[model samples]
Target: MLKSSLNIKVDRRDAKLVMAHFYVAFIALLVGGLAGLLQVLVRSGKFELPAGIGYYQILTVHGVVLGLVLTTFFIMGFQLAAVSKTAGTFTNKQRTIGWIGFWIMTIGTVAAAVMILLNEASVLYTFYAPLQAHFVFYLGLTLVVVGSWAVGTTIILKYAEWRRANPGQPSPLLTFMALVNTMMWTVATIGVAATVLIQLLPWSLGLVETVNVGVSRTLFWYFGHPLVYFWLLPAYMAWYVMIPKIIGGKIFSDSLARMSFILFLLFSIPVGFHHQLLEPGIDPAWKFLQVVLTFLVVIPSLMTAFSLFATFESYGRSQGATGLFGWLKKLPWKDARFTVPFIGMLAFIPAGAGGIVNASHQMNQVVHNTVWVTGHFHLTVATAVVLTFFGVSFWLVPHLTGRKLTKKMNKLALIQGYLWAIGMTFMSGAMHAAGLLGAPRRSSFSEYGGAAQAAEWIPYQIAQAVGGSILFIAIILMLYIFVNLAFFAPKGEEEFPVGEAANQTEKAPMVFENWKLWLGITVLLILFAYTIPFIDLIKNAPPGAQGYKLW
Candidate 1:
């Protein structure tokens, strides 16, 4: 069985390396969560910063650590473990390369964190040029990105070697998805690499007198929107490949899952222009093109939803559940792993709908730069992505450490997931409502006692603060669960929930495995989508703007 294959023992070196990434990632969550709690309270007019600990400063910490640091490290660690376990042992050389990458990223993270803590780099995580951070901050982030490339390179090389060794056999599901995710990341990071190395770092260091703000933003969005997918695809991997088997069901269609990943790779990058729809000088035609592509990207998610529900129905029928909706009850709600991702997926339904609103040019004008955008992404990256990470860690940490997660602890983790969902309902719901009343995002305070329009935002801000408090408590509970699983549980091995289609004979087509072809299509789409817009941005660009230390 696939589950037994997943339990195959890995060398301690690879396990330790993966665990190291998890440790740093969790520490980021802790620090970032604390900052989040402070941000909400301050915005509510309920708390004031101690002098020198500024809001933007803490916001930068929250974004960089939670968004960039935690995601990068955790994905690298998760993919490495996936490839190794699913394919075979990582050669000693591969482990060395991975460790080298990990250390470089760690050094970069430390450098950036120190700069932020010292209040020298308060430009915020978007690091929109024109508002510059210390040169080292850019350099450190560049290194973090480069380090990820190193780790991604390891995955690619290992997959190639795997293909050669296995000859005609299909790559294992987890390994296949991990490799695809790596390829997509490598493709996406090119935009950011060009932005940082060519533009921001030079501007920050004063090597360039100015950098074109429009061009810089164009480059950033090229990477930025796809970065959302980078955060998401791993969680999607869990939903598609792992969840069904965990809950005693089979993957509805392996080929459908493979197609979705391929679709994402092809459509995800080209569509990032949707983020820039409201920005000036860019052609409306180009924005419309991206809008169309954005809608195309939604198809795969619909496929996934259908596939998952079919899996549930099939399982429920087997369990003697009668009619419509009965299947939902038959799901493994008692299992923390299943319950956590299930809730995360449910959150994505509305989150995806909000994204559609943002992508539509006319609708976007209504909520652009408002707190509604903040509300949308919280349901996505914060709840869907972060909660999924927490769920995977419940088993992953124990699996890596060769320990058991106690049943009581499992119950607590499930509770933690519910708490997160409840908190997000309060926070994101209020943000959406207030944003409709014209509340802005990225502002330290929205409540101005004299402005009645601003006064409309006060109650919502307070609700956000309360919700954030609950979220903080949930994060603490997650950390406690993770630590206990890692260090205190009894020695045992955990099985991976690797599902198969109900129809055993339904093999994926050969095209699904054609990486070179898919990679080619991915490149072509990027060129088609970005080349003209980027050219326009650079050619008509107003004289580049000088850096302002605007924190």
Candidate 2:
């Protein structure tokens, strides 16, 4: 079993499908990174966008391309490759479905990109109503979501087949993680889909003259919070299963990992209300309830933190390290695969703390709609999740492409990771400080008629510009490494590492595999959290707002 698992590589055909996703993802990174640089420079109050280009247009491009296009494509591709490798190769039908999904998503991405470039759609990633886009943008995003469903269908089908073949065993850990994320995404997206199809699309198309802004936003946050976790669980998969193998250590506990994932599935969805603590239309009681549920998610997060420390310490002790902190010295700091994601882990400490503050109703008021909120997610998604994705790419990209990650490239990858950390420290740290001093988020560079408070934000904005410049350099470096790994590297096999548990004899509970129970509870929790609040939003909504082409 060990030998077979170790030797498993994504099949050649599946590799093409997965690589297709990465290609689009990297292209998005280039476009979005440029947009991000422009955004910071504009906000610095020291630069102007030539040709009368609006700052918000570039902001929209940065947010949508990176937050939606890059993350979704990369995640779908990674999950597909993982399932194919661990659960046996996809059947011909499954692979075909995967290809079909890929095309639909690519087509959708192109359509949306065209609209954004044309400035017909600048609603940003959240696409909030009252600030409408061209209908084509909505349709394009719809197709992206629909395409992901098709890809997710393949994962589900593959998992079903694995269970049928194995009878009583737990599914592969990576495959199971993929399934959890897919299911959570599927459930979560219904909110966005509903808002788009029922509210935004019609309003944009002029079939509806007005949209209930409250309900639209409510539905959005329903999808929004879990979207964070959707980006995260794949990183967790790497942490729980892949990192151990990378570091030559055993998984601390397979059961612990699965249980944590199950908890995430249960708790991550019903907590979207925490994002709307300040919004009217929802009862404060409902918001409070959701906030409590949001805090529950911290349990699993802490569980993961505990499990990782144990994994590291146990591995360190195994190597004859004795001091309480000796494990820190024992880790493979030179190996980019381990070091890059580890930096992400360190970032999460602050990220999680910020999340707690954001979820607290009173505390949220202090930073609500402020750049601090923006700074918080930068750490979570941009640092923690993205760095892990990059780490995964250092190996997974080459593994799929039938190449080795050359030693020179590995060293470069480390530099890329460290550069990202430094750049984010300057950018996000300044954003947080500026936010506390009354800076607004999602705004163009403005002196506010030379207001004193606004004057205070300029220096931090300049710091952000400096940081953005450094981050853009790192992005270029990453893209270069990706190209080498995909094409120019020497032809060789790269191990697709999947770690064994330290206690292999201990079987994961069958309960952990009971999806019916888990999904049922997930639905119950979401319904309990949102049903009344949603009804209140619809029934008590104010006069609807007409669409505005703000740009």
Candidate 3:
């Protein structure tokens, strides 16, 4: 007897509710992409979108809006689905709160973007410096983060509600991932939130005369870099659990997916200073510790990448796409189902490779504060992360609206993914070379004047510009598809499927829980960070050793 294929027809109302976040996320991407193009234009020394204010403000806006806001909003959608699926739980009340959170965060984010465009907060997304923003920018950012926390709270409580209702069985994989990531978010956001809410707000408001720059920067990344993981984990979840189901395969290892999510939750915090590799820190020991553990953080990511590839490879070979790497070509590339997602991970690997190199102590010095830094993270956060949101949206709209995506737009979306990966890789490569040849990021015009690649870099910048243009247009095509599904496409009265109808349900009985494993490992790393530095501080004490700045 042969196994039959499942034709998943998910809940119409539920599907649309889930898909709405993607449209908003795409809109945010469009806004950010415009800012990115402008920043590149100004960087290329060809055109300044606006005089005087220049690149700083535009880059700042682009970075925060696209990098943080868009990604977070989209992930919240995953969280929503998880809550509903696990315990058969969905609440109009909590879902209402979720929508409110989106609007609040979006408004706050847009307000911050406007401030950046007005040249009020050129402090960049890191917003560190002798430079500061208008209090409003900081306030806007705070509200955005707060609103996001609202979504997180809704997710966590909803998961709990599901668990209570379900009693003994494991929650769905999607719910499990969401619960764990939100828990991580709660832990990770605290330090930065405390610094911002308690210190930066008062100081920026002029209620306080001064605050410690060193301490604030320390606290910020303590909350910040883990922030990157919060955004990336959803993409990882999609890669692991969601994509497998979409591609008609069970997760290679359901237990392994749980472990990966758990690892992300536990270790994603406490590994902050890889971003601050060049900046002054609590101690060399601290920086060194983060550098080492950054490699550890890479493990779960690598695991997911490999597992996803292997699972897909198995499916492809089963379908007769045989031998070595030949299975890669047999994947169902035309179904927005497959193609939209495949390259997001494809782009992620090189971006992560750049990240690992950039995080190393020695290489960090070479690229710190340079365009290479910009390009590398652009590939990771903006390209790979955001593309996941877009890809998932494309995969989902048909189910939601009950219409098929036209083959024309499907091809366009696939082409868009290719353009994004190819364009960003070469663009980032040029940026890395320019950085090696010595070019500072965040500067409008080249202080280098006339270096060799400085001239050649023009074409790469043009490539990025063209890539962004295509990406922007691809996003429009996505919107059109979703709209057609929602309104124009004939409504299907056919009953939707339930149970295993979702992107992923939980694996049975995970003992590794991977969180415990990650925590054990991370504690050792943190011990390495704090113990030696504190011991040194004690031994080197003059009068007030606690007052020592180890830089």
- Cα lDDT tens digits for candidate 2, 332-443: 9999999999999999999999999999999999999999998998999999999999999999999999999889999999999999999999999999999899798888
RMSD of each: 2.3, 2.0, 5.0
Please state the error at residue 363 of candidate 2 in Å. 0.7
lDDT of each: 0.86, 0.90, 0.67
Candidate 3 deviant stretches above 4 angstroms: 1-20, 51-53, 401-403, 446-507, 510-551
Evaluated at residue 87, the lDDT of candidate 1 is: 77
Off by over 4 Å in 1: 1-7, 446-449, 544-551
Candidates 1 and 3 compared by TM-score, better number: 1
Worst 10 residues of 2 by lDDT: 542-551
Q: Per-residue lDDT tens digits of candidate 3, residues 1-551?
A: 21221234444444555666666666777777778777766666666564576666777877787777777767876666545544344567766777777678877877777788788888877877346678888888887888888777777666667556565656666777787788777777777677777767776677765555655676677677788888888777777766766667656877777777776765676677777766543577777777777787788887887788778887788778866888777777776656766777777878888888788888788888887887777777767776776676654555556665566657766776776666566566667666665667877656544766467556555655565555555556656655665566554432221223222454467454334655566566546554554354345443332333222
How badly does each model clash, as a count of residue pairs? 0, 0, 3
TM-score of 2: 0.97
The lDDT, on a scale of 0 to 1, for candidate 1 is: 0.86
| lDDT measured at residue 534 in model 3 versus the true structure, 0 to 100 | 39
User: Across residues 314-350, which tens digit of lDDT does each residue of candidate 1 receive?
Assistant: 9999999987888788888899999998899999999
